[model samples]
Target: MFTPQGPTLRELAVQALSSVERGYDLLAPKFDHTPFRTPDLLLDPVARALRELGPYETGLDLCCGTGAGLGVLREVCAGRAVGVDFSAGMLEVARAGGPAASYVRGDALALPFGPVFDLVVSFGAFGHFVPGQYPDLFGQVRQVLRPGGQFAFPLPAPPRPGSRGYWAMLGFDGVMRVRNAVWRPPFVMYYRPFRLGDVHRELGRAGFDVALRALPELGERPDGSPRCRLVVATRRS
Candidate 1:
C-alpha cells in the first residue's frame, strides 16, 4: 500500500521494468512514502535492542536506502555514523534528509573500509541479493568490522501457510520471477529466497558468531514464537 505521495502505478511499472539499481533510483524520492521503506515501528525496537547490547562507538548502515537505519545507528553509536549504498540517487536523498552522518555510494559485497566500524546494520535490502550471495555479503560486513563488532538486522517471522499474507507474498515473488525472465537487466527480489537457516550457515562460514534477540514490540505468533527477531552477528574477539 502506498500513500498519495508515493509512486504512481505507472511509475511503479516503469521501476519494475528497469534494473534494481535504476528502479530504486527512480523510486528514491518517494521511497519513504511507500510501504517498501523499513517502518519506524520495526526500526525503533531494533534500535532499543542494539542500545541494550551496546554503547558502540562507530557504526555503518549497509545498503542504507534513504538512511532510516542510519537513524537507528545514530541512537546507539557514539562517535561517527556512516550510510553506504550503491544507488547514487538514493544516497542523494539520504544525504539531504538523514542525520549528520557520512553517506557513501559503494557496493556492499566489496566494502571499502576495514575494521572501521563497531556496528553495522541493514534493513529490507537482503531481498535484492540472491541466496548464494549471502556468504560474500556477510564476509564483507565481517571484514569491515573490528573484533567483537556486530552486524545486526531485524527479520520478521515467515508468513504461515494458507494465510492471505502468504499467498500475497507468493504471488508477488511469482510476478517478479516472470518479469525478470521476460525483461532485461532483471530486477532481483524474492521474498522467500533468504531463509533463516541458510543465513545462519552463511554467517557462520563468514566467521560471525550469530545470535537472535526477540523484538518484543512485535509480539508473538500463535505458536508462541517471536513475530520478529534481531539477528546479531558478532565478529570474533
Candidate 2:
C-alpha cells in the first residue's frame, strides 16, 4: 500500500517496466512514503538489537535507500555513519533528507571502502540481488568490515504455505517473472529468492560467523517459530 504522496499506479507501471536501478531512480522521490520502504517497526527492533551488541564506532548502510536504515545506524553507531547505494537518484533524495551521514554511490558487489566500518546494515534491498549473487554480495560486505565487525539485517520467516500473504507473494513473484521475461533490462526482485539456509551457508563461505537473533517483539508463528529474526554475521577477527 502507498500513501497519498506515493507513486501513482501509472507511475508504478512505468517503474515496473524499467530496469531495477532506473525504476528505483524514478521512485526515489516518494520512496519513504511507500510501504516498499523498510518499515520503522522493523528498523526500531534492529536498532535495539544492534545497540545491545554495539558500542560500534562506524557504521555503513548497504543499499541505503532514502537513508531509513542509516537512521538506525546513527542511533547505534557513535562516530560516523555512511550510506552506499548504486542509485544516484536515491542518493540525491538521501542527501536532501540531510541524514548527518555520508553517502556513496557504488556497486555492492565491488565496495570501494577498506576495513573501515564496525558494522554494516541493509534493509529491504536483498530482493534486488539475484539468487546466485549472494556469495559475492556477502564477500563485498565482509571486505568493508573490520575484524569482528558485523553485517546485520532483518529476515522475516517465510509465510505459511496456504496463507493469504504467502499466496500474495507467490503471485507477485510470478508477475515479476512474467514481466522480466518480456521486458528489456529486467527489474529483478523476487520475495522468496533469499532463503535463510542458503544465506547462512553463503555468509559462512564469505568468512562470516553467522548467527540468528530472534526479534521477540514480532512474536512467533503458530508452530512456535520466530516470526522474524536478525541475521548477525560477524567477520573473523
Candidate 3:
C-alpha cells in the first residue's frame, strides 16, 4: 500500500533487484510515501511508552531509515539524539526532514560508538536481519548502551493462522527464499525468523533484562492479546 507520491512499480522492481543498501539508497527520497516507512500510528504509541519509561538523556535510533524513530527519541530524550543507518542516501534524507539530531552512517551489526546512549529504538528494521545474525545485532546495540540503558522496539503480533495476512506473509517469505537462492547480493528481509520467544531469549543472551509493554493504542486481538507490544530490553547493571 503506497501513496501516489510513492515509488513506481518499475522503481520498486529495480529496488528489489538491487542489494539492500543500494535499494534503500534508490528508494530513500520516496520512502516516507511508501508503506515500508514506520507509520505515525506505530511511532506514536512507541513514543508514549518511552516517555513513561524515560527521561533519557541521549537516544539512538538503530537503522533509522528516514529518521522516523528520531522523532520518538526527540520526544523522550532530554539531551542529544542520533540516528544511524548504513545508507548514505537515507541519512541525507533523514537529516533533511527528520527532527534536529545527529545522523551517522554506520552498520547496525558494527555500531561505531561507545556505551554512551541511554535509550535506543528501532522500527521496521528487524526483518532486514536474519535469525542467526540476531546475536551480533543485539550485541552491537548493547555495546552502545549504558548499563541500565534500554533497547526498545515495537513488535506487532503475528497474523491469525490461515488468515489472509498470514498467507500473504508466508508467500512473501517463500518468494524471498527463492530469490535469495538464485540471486546475488541477496536482500535479507524475512518476517518468519523474528519471533518473540526467540528474540526474548537472544536479548537475555545479550545481557538485557527484557520486558514487553502493551501498546493499547494499537488495539487487541480477538483472543484479547495485545495486537502490538513494545519490547523494552534494559541492559543489566
Candidate 4:
C-alpha cells in the first residue's frame, strides 16, 4: 500500500520491469512515502538493540536507501555515520534530507571500503539479494567492518502457514519467479528466501559469530516466541 505522495501504479509497473538498480533509482524520489521504506516501528527497536551491544565508532548502513537506517547508526555510533547504496537517486534524496551522515554510491556485493567501521546495519533491503548471494554479501559487510564489529539487521518471523500474510508472500514470490523467467533486467525482490536458519548458517560461513536478540517491543506470537529478532553478527576477530 502507498500514500498519495508515493509512486503511482503506472510508476510502480515501470519500476517492476526494470533492473533492481534502475527500478530503485526510479522509485527513490517517492520511496519514503511508500510502504517499502523502513518504518520507525522497525528502526527504533533495532537502534535499541544496537545500543545495548555497542559503544561503536564509525558506522555504515548497507544498502542505505534514503538513509532510513542511518538514524539508527547516528543513535548508536559515537563517531560518524555513513550510508552506501548503488543508487545515486536514493543518495540524492538522502543527502537533501540531511540524515546526519555521508553517502556513497556503491554496490553491496563489492563494497569500496576498508575494514574501518565499528558497526554495520541494514534495513528493508535484503530482498534484492538471492540465497546464493548471501555469502558474497556477508563477506562484503565483513570486509568493511573492524575486527569484533557488528553487522546487524532485524528479521521478522515468517508468517504462519495458511495465514493471509503467508499466502501473500508466497504469491508475490511466485509472481516474481515467473516475471524473472520471462523478463529481461529482472527486478529481484522476494520475501520468502531470507529465512532465519539459512541466514544464520551463511553468516557463520562468512566468518561471523551470529546471535539473535529478541525485540520485545514488536511483541510475541501466540507461542510466546518473539515476533522479530535482531540478527547480530559480529565479525570473527
Best by lDDT: 3
Off by over 4 Å in 4: none
Off by over 4 Å in 2: none
lDDT of 3 by residue, 1-237 (tens): 267899999999899989999999999999989888888999999999999999899999999999988999999999999999999999999999899999999999999999999999999999999999999999999999999999999999999999999999999999999999999889989987899999999999999999999999999999999999999999998
For model 2, how does the per-residue alpha-carbon lDDT over 1-237 read when each residue is reduced to its tens digit? Answer: 257898999999999998888998999998888888888889899999999998899999999988999999889999999999999999999999847999999999999999999999999999988879998999899999999999999999999999999999999999999998888989999999899999999999999999999999889999899999999999997
Sort all candidates by TM-score, best to worst: 3, 4, 1, 2
Candidate 1 C-alpha lDDT tens digits along 69-136: 99998899999999999999899999999888999989998999989999999999999999888888
Provide TM-scores for the models: 0.98, 0.98, 0.98, 0.98
- Candidate 4 to native Cα RMSD, angstroms: 0.8
Candidate models: Cα lDDT each: 0.93, 0.93, 0.94, 0.93
RMSD of each: 0.9, 1.0, 0.8, 0.8
lDDT of 1 at 198: 90
Model 4: per-residue lDDT, tens digit, 91-200? 99999994789999999999999999999999988999999999999999999999999999999999999999999999999999999999998889999999999999
Off by over 4 Å in 1: none
Worst 10 residues of 4 by lDDT: 1-10
Clashing pairs in 3: none
Tell me the lDDT of candidate 3. Answer: 0.94
